[model samples]
Target chain A: MLTQRLANIVFTILLLIACIWFAVIAQGFEASGLLASSGLPSKFFPQLLLAFTGLCAVIIAGLYLIKGQAGGDSGETVFANFAEARRGLLMMVVAVACYFVWKRFGFVPMAAVMGPLSLLAMGVKAISHYAIVLALTVLVYLVFTQLLNIQLT
Target chain B: MYGDLQALMTALTHLAQPVSLLLLVGGIVLGLVIGILPGLGPPIAIALALPFTFYLDTVPSLILLLGIYSAAIYGGSISAIAVGIPGTGAAIATVQDGHKMFKAGQGGEALGFSLTGSIIGGLFSVICLALISPLLAQLAAKFGPREYLAISVFGLVVVVRVAGKSLSKGLLMGGLGIFLTTWGLDELNGTERYTFGSYHLYEGLPLVPFLVGLFAMSEVMIGAERVLNKIEFSDSSLKVKLPGLRQLSRMKSVLLRSSIIGTIIGIIPGEGAAVGAFFAYSEAKRKSADPDKFGTGIPEGIVAPETANNATVGGALVPTLTLGVPGSPAAAVLLGALLIQGLAPGPRLFAERPDLMYSIFIGLFLINILMMFIGLIAIRFAAKLIMVPTSIILPTVMLLSFVGIYSVSNSFFNVGVLLGAGILGYVVRKLGYSIAPLSIGFVLGPILENALRQSMTIADGSIVEFFNTPIGLTIYAVLLLTICWDRITALLRRN
Candidate 1:
């Protein structure tokens, strides 16, 4: 019971921190001089949305802290089991890696690593799966580059 | 009327071109392949084709996408009838009777009936589009910002209700989705919102990349979770045994009623093919002499939902092309395509480009006609294609995503966004958040913001004055009635 309550309180604090971050970001921004005279500047809508979202987050956090787990609607988490958590987090890493690789190297290099990297991330096995992935990649390259005439650097 | 006639003439001319003919066939074949594949739907099929459209003429490009849209919905039924797995959400209701028929050794019969029913429903709705779009466009010309606001609100509420388990969760996501659009420069005023300090943020989140990311990229990630699972189903009933005249005559009433139901539901902002289908199925069951025989592979049961669901494609397009409040999520994505082409959907579009509207009507009609022949040949080929390894399909699709999104802006940032959106889509779908609300919310967000801001300005900060318009007030009243229907019925039962 204490552990659950502690979890709720911590989550609420984290949400509150996120709200403060948004509020600070809003404050740090500048609205154009054209709309500066319009009483409600451009920041008005974003600030309003952020504020409301923050308030809701705070309320939800309060509910969790006060009433404990609030009836129903709980299901699988993003990191449910050990295998899933590792895969999800690792996939996020691979995605970032792919993005950077696409940035540094060309699409061809990114394409080469992306399949095997993602496959390895998902724990998919067999050498044939890798061949299938490579063949599929080459087919995509041929169609997009040769047929559709897209310039993929 | 003169403009519509001219547009029809232009469309006929466009269709005469060999490229358009080839594309029409190509799109239908592609749509069939997509529809047979589990976890891919019409939106992904269109998104994959979006980048390619950048290089082509508008007419051929649109015809190709429209072919994909119309045929993809029809294709999902093929899978449902054959393997008991619905290829798309719209075909879920079809699975009950369709798969049952397949299981009972009537696989060819079910496929035939479903394909025939789909064409009938699709053509019927296309006819409705030809007749009714101009009329609805005329009516929508009278709406002001307040009226638009009311309609948008109704859409959002309906979407939230239809989307998922928790109302608050839907609301939160919907709000978050809209709030993201409040970035970039304001349209009404030249002020910057939450653009943070990047030139890329100036345009806010780019529409195509954002959407493709949200729908396609997300789906890919979600597919990763279940990709390893052995999905094994085969149907010997590969050849289509289309219903004859007598069978068609017998199911005529079922076909007509479901078409009407589908068209009406399609007119509503939130409801789409799935809702129309399930409702038609239930109505047929309620009207039937033996309700218990519904899931027992009755032809009426299969026809009612399958036809209605396909009809919904046309029904959903009605408001999308006119009022600009998308009648469905798929229509919302279609709306994004319109915006990309610099075709702003509204009453103005009707007046300025009646020919384009007319062409869409005639083209949708042609697309459905071509779908029948395309479906006949492709369903057999598509079933065999399903045996194509997902390992190959996934990497190829991913590369297509890269090339497609890249070809649009020639930017790697957009591709990253696509991958990001795909991951988001995968996660939320796994979390049971229907991508419909998110997609609709994103499209409707700017419209909602502008309408509300303008209305408030006119109202002088008074909330009461916002409800001043007669059309707007009536729309709000209808929205209230729809939201309260379940609660009112529950209360009556208690009393």
Candidate 2:
């Protein structure tokens, strides 16, 4: 289980690094012609926001490091146990896989398999739940295709 | 007044159409169903319905979405009373007293009180919206870039203050949300910032898909993790029993006060229904003669939060329609729906589409009236909905999100954005951060950036001139006062 104290420290550090990188990249931004000289530069707002974000990330990381909890967390883990983590991470992967499947094989194949794949990811053993989810998938497909006149293919 | 009456007549003429009427009822039913399901809320309900509005006329679409907005808040109490779980965050305050009442075998009475109080509160706010919006719109119409900048700053800061326990985490998410908007071509200079050679990135990010994914898809993943949890509910106590006039009269003051509190809180940007509900609950408990009786199956406990939560629907729309600023995250999504209809929200919308404006006011009144009937019928079956396993809901919501988002633009890229946003939302939510600031900041980013740059140009590098406007100064003063209000109260109490 990943405790919030550890998670915040790790995540905020990565976020701070990303903010610095993005801010540096923002320096390369340039407007063409007369617009370049008109008012603030395009990088101004992004860099300002990056600075604010980086500052907040630093504060959060510092708080977590010093107190071991930022928001009254009471040193609780992010997830309760391994089972909860497995379900959550697996579902995320399934969601991504469903998106890629739609892009690769098209919406029909994706639609047919998404229900079963998601059911598997969630560790469901009920046959009726699978049937119901599949039925809902078909209903969604019909609503888009027939009622809304959306081209699914 | 005569013009208001004329517009009301025109709104009635439009709303009399069969399709509009059907969609309005359908929206309420959908909202009720979704709100009865644990882990789904008004924002998710509105987001999922946003894409369907693409095929609808402006009046029906707005009507449909408004129906969903109001009823979703009301429907949350059903599950709160029937089971221990609150179907929406707005219902969290209801759970203590509501579930207590259920366990005490007064569930029907509890449901009835919640339903009636919600209707009264909702109607009160709609009346307030109708009376106040026109005046607010007239005033807001005079706002300049500086005023808008002040308003945006106020919105973001207030949201960050109240969104999470850690101010830094909320600010980090809010800043991150605004920073992401700086991608694609800069509107001021047309300079490519971070398009990264993709035409899809040319628009920065699609608003509706990103928002829908953030609310709905994230919940789906969370729901997936809790799939093994089982809910047991008995239908025997599901019937609603209306309170008598005498019973209502006894609690009339509490109801009235809560409605006012909810409306005022709703008018403040970033203070959402959940906040209003809890605020009203605390206030009611403070004012009660037997304050210790709260959370012990009392009618006042149920009424305070239910009324306030429903009232927030109307209060939230006041700023959204008048100032082009959302009063709540749900209203932010509602604003996105308006943008999709090719209508820009703000003071001009009221002047340009008086009938549509009247439709919202009049339509809300009708929705509240109609909810009494629908809620009665729906409560009898709402128990079964609460019992539906999350494993079934997870897959269905994911599929709907994928196909619904794809159907919006017929573009796979938008779907990709949806998936990415869902992952981002899930990650932040798991790490003890609230997504309210993120969503609201994303919605307000364009306005904030545009206002700031334009204000800077108007000021010509003079900081004093940027704060020169009377309206801007007033807004800033109010923001400063709001931030210090708690400390001021604490000092007074000490004294």
Candidate 3:
């Protein structure tokens, strides 16, 4: 139930803070030897972009604070209901978990569990959907490993 | 001209091979299937297939991706007509009249007109690409750093302006995309920027993985949110019927005008297919005898957007191939595919690989022609594709993204970048920002930085001197006009 106005204000403030942090970090960048006297310093472009981005963020924050909308979702919430939010957030967690699983246990285990975990996240109850997804996961594994000679692990 | 002809012949000989022919057909089928699926568009389709291209020769790979590119744009119309939901952003304009016509029990006829118009628009744009690319490349060959800077600015600003309703939000995302590119060792000074002590970050974030994750993985998460929603359609209306020669002849003017509009818009860097479709649709409605009847399931309504959207494929390649600036977001991903092949796009490509250039031109023509036959057979099966449950697709796409990106380098870092990019894309998109400017900005970042540095060196910090070149001035003039066009129209209306 996050409103666009409230969300933009919060996001813009955080973005402004991040831009300042990155700009300070950019000050540490240095060049050596012949590259030292190049056309411009390495930090110039990034800092300039950060400045512009920060400026835009401030403008957006002001627009939202004053007008209460930025021309999208005037009075609507970010998600339709709790179910949609839960599904979306859980899917994101599942995706990240799959990545970590792949990194820790190799490709096979990750591929095997990714589908069922995702189906569970989406609240699917159909057994046939799981079967088809499992078959697809296996097919993908075989194609990459056998046909293309790619090392999945 | 004779050399071009010889190159075309060589390309024809290469495409006539059994392997190339099979990939071409396979690419079209894959493209159509992907296009018919809601939430999967050309960029994602090309991104998923990009890794497979790493295994094949340049000619076959480019041919396969080109088939996907052209057909995907055309394929979007199928779902637009059969259901109210457009499979791609380009097909949104088609839904106004296309879906209405389907409910009127003229589904087959609606599909036919869209298919025919798409083919015609696509073919016309290919012809334009063939005739216009060489000439444009000749002119682009003379461009200097300042000219490139102007072009990069024009491309970024134009894309940001059109990407969403809020300019500030779009610009913020665009700036963030370019800023991310500044990570790693600087190409100009070799100074470490934001590598964070990882050798993998030395060369900066990999393009293919970042792009694939941005388009495909983000859509997967978004699709996951609506997994329970059901798509309903009638299989009885899925048959496709080609319009008679007389029907096509009557709509000749609409087809030609839309083709021209699409191609011109496509040649303008960052305009994209959706803009072209909407513009052509508005123009068609404005010129009609009864503009009020436009959304009431008229043939002209379907034809304008369909033709223009497909035509953008050819038109967009004009800038992408000639100037190294992508004409659309899909073309931006196509640019990544080119970089993966170690082939840099621009005027240099035309000279260095005339055969490849010829192959693209000839290959596009073949894809459009072959799409008509393939679309006829494919329409009957589209209902099944359209009904694919999102729960199944979301996991499959995420898996593909992870595996496909990892296969690129066998590097876990690239996979991490993919996941990171997907999250960033999801957050920004959910906040009402368009991914078009971000993707395009990332692609243009290196070019923009290099050009800016070089131009500053040449100008020696003189701002006026940077604007002295005729070509740069011309590009800036066009950009200025484009920016002020709406304001000028508003002023005239007020007067």
Best-matching candidate per lDDT? 2
Which regions of candidate 1 deviate over 4 angstroms? A1-20, A28-34, A55-72, A75-92, B1-4, B492-495
Weakest 10 consecutive residues of candidate 1 chain B by summed lDDT: B424-433
Q: Per-residue CA lDDT of candidate 3, range B1-495, in tens?
A: 226777777888889988899999999999999899988999999999999999988889988999999888888899999988898999999999999999999999999999999999999999999999999899989999999999999999999999999989889888988988899899988999888889999999889988998999889878888999988888778888788999989888889899999999998888988899999999999988889999999999999999999999999999899989999999999998888899989888888889898889888899999999999999988988888888888898899889988987899999999999998888778888889989998999999999998999999989898888999999999999999999999999999
Please, what are the lDDT tens digits per residue for candidate 1 over residues A57-130?
A: 56555655666432233432444456755555456567668778988998899989988887887677878888
Clashing pairs in 2: none
lDDT of 2 by residue, B300-404 (tens): 999999999999989999999998889999999999999999988888888888999989998998999999999999998897888888888888888888888
Question: What DockQ do you compute for every candidate structure?
Answer: 0.40, 0.88, 0.85
Better of 1 and 2 by lDDT: 2
Ranking by TM-score: 2, 3, 1
DockQ of 3: 0.85
Give the winner by DockQ. Answer: 2
lDDT of 1: 0.77
Docking class of 2: high
Candidate 2 regions with alpha-carbon error over 4 angstroms: B1-6
Candidate closer to the true structure by TM-score (higher is better), 1 or 3: 3
Name the better of 2 and 3 by DockQ.
Answer: 2
**lDDT of model 1 at residue A49?**
68
Better of 2 and 3 by lDDT: 2
